[model samples]
Target: MGPLIRPLRSFANGLGLAWWARVQTHGPDVTYWFGPFVTRGSLERELPLFLEDVASEAPVSIDHSCLRCRRGEPFTIPASDG
Candidate 1:
């Protein structure tokens, strides 16, 4: 099942139709984009691990949202807007 889905996920991601987790951490003031998941469910399922990994950095706050949109390189960036 996983092997079969990789290609589809890549295709959807290329077309800007895949799901992603946009995580924002306050202390370091960074935003991390964590996926090109084939489905929202898969993104949701895998989000906790990503969160835990970031939490280990001990940021002052953490926030996130799931988006189905296109994003390119530089998965990690400074929180520029607010």
Candidate 2:
């Protein structure tokens, strides 16, 4: 695997559970934050596409109250998605 994929896979494996992933924008940059994810393979498969979309958009911010909710808990819905 490439450098990016390696780290992503490692991160997912380290979590040991599914979690939600969200894109947070700041000025010209974007941040990817993780939350309680419902499906295992969903984020893994869609991550690349999601990043591409974010890149194309340049700068966009999503307002989510649950950005850090249930951070370490397992099998819980992210506040943002709820």
Candidate 3:
């Protein structure tokens, strides 16, 4: 299942049917898109690890959601400090 996840995710992403973790953080004011998961269950299972890594940075606040949608390049979007 682990090995197959990558290829399955790729296929689903190609068809614009992939699951994604949309993580938003305050303070730094950034939005990070983390995944082209083939299933929502898989995304949910893996979200905590990603969140933990991000939490290490110490953002003012954190918010997240699971989304099934197509996404392109440049997964990281940081809000302008200006």
Candidate 4:
């Protein structure tokens, strides 16, 4: 299989993709804060652009499951020093 087609092969499984955002409007200047977790990088980049396009939108969704599972004892601890 050609490398170019690899990207298109996932069309059948779109949900598993890191982030799937579809901007339908550029009228809102509001930012949607979805998943400062899995797609933080992508969210940071697209959020501003999306808001620049659609400022009227709100209720931004920060929908990420990466942190949801590690809900127990969420904080990291340093190793003990003797």
Candidate 5:
């Protein structure tokens, strides 16, 4: 039973799809912390629409974090080995 349940739990955690609905309904704010691979411009452009979609039920705060390059823009950095 333990072995069977572990796989199911891992799969569920990996999916993380349920959180979207849950957050939309319950969260006042959603913070998405991403690695340095995602572009800031893309996020800035799309986040408003995403927030609007999620806020169809109620308003919620949306925030995120990413690398900053010399130009004071969102930048991507490779993950450290350690």
Candidate 6:
């Protein structure tokens, strides 16, 4: 086990899907917001403030920032898939 982020573990478990199961099903469009970041067989942070954004009625922007590397990694995941 790793020093997995507890909120993520609980949230992922709440979805009733294994870590890899989500990947196989949703692939890269996998919303880490309220989704899991599995680290070495365990989970990490459950995307703080992300779920709130998801539930909000306001518009959301994915390209607002380059989150992962903060360098805009030049990757994109389509919203239609989500």
Task: Provide C-alpha RMSD values for all models, in order.
Answer: 2.3, 10.3, 1.5, 14.3, 14.6, 12.0
TM-score of model number 4: 0.28
Candidate No. with top lDDT: 1
Better of 4 and 6 by lDDT: 4
Q: Give the whole-model CA lDDT for all candidates, comma-separated.
A: 0.92, 0.49, 0.92, 0.35, 0.37, 0.33
Clashes of each: 0, 3, 0, 17, 0, 0
Residue 76 in candidate 6 has what lDDT? Answer: 26
lDDT (tens digit, per residue) of candidate 2 on 14-78: 56543556556655444455544344465566566666766676655543222222334342233
Task: List the candidate 4 regions with Cα displacement exceeding 4 Å.
Answer: 1-15, 20-38, 56-82
The digit string of per-residue lDDT tens for model 6 on 1-82 reads 3566566555544554424211111322323222333332332243325434543534332312112211111222334632
Question: By summed lDDT, which 10 consecutive residues of candidate 3 come out lowest?
Answer: 1-10
Q: Residues 2-53, candidate 5: write the lDDT tens digits.
A: 5564454345435541111112222443333232212356445655665565
Query: In model 4, which range of ten residues has the least summed lDDT?
Result: 65-74
Any residue pairs clashing in model 3, and if so which? none
lDDT of 2 at 51: 62
TM-scores for candidates 1 onward, in order: 0.88, 0.35, 0.89, 0.28, 0.31, 0.21
Ranking by lDDT: 1, 3, 2, 5, 4, 6
Judging by TM-score against the true structure, name the best candidate. Answer: 3
Off by over 4 Å in 2: 1-18, 28-37, 60-82
Residue pairs with backbone overlap in model 5: none
Of candidates 6 and 2, the better by lDDT: 2
Better of 2 and 4 by TM-score: 2
Off by over 4 Å in 3: 1-4
Over 1-82, each residue of candidate 3 has an lDDT whose tens digit, in order, gives 6788778888899898999999999988999999988889989999999999999999999999999998877899999878
Score candidate 5 by TM-score against the native.
0.31
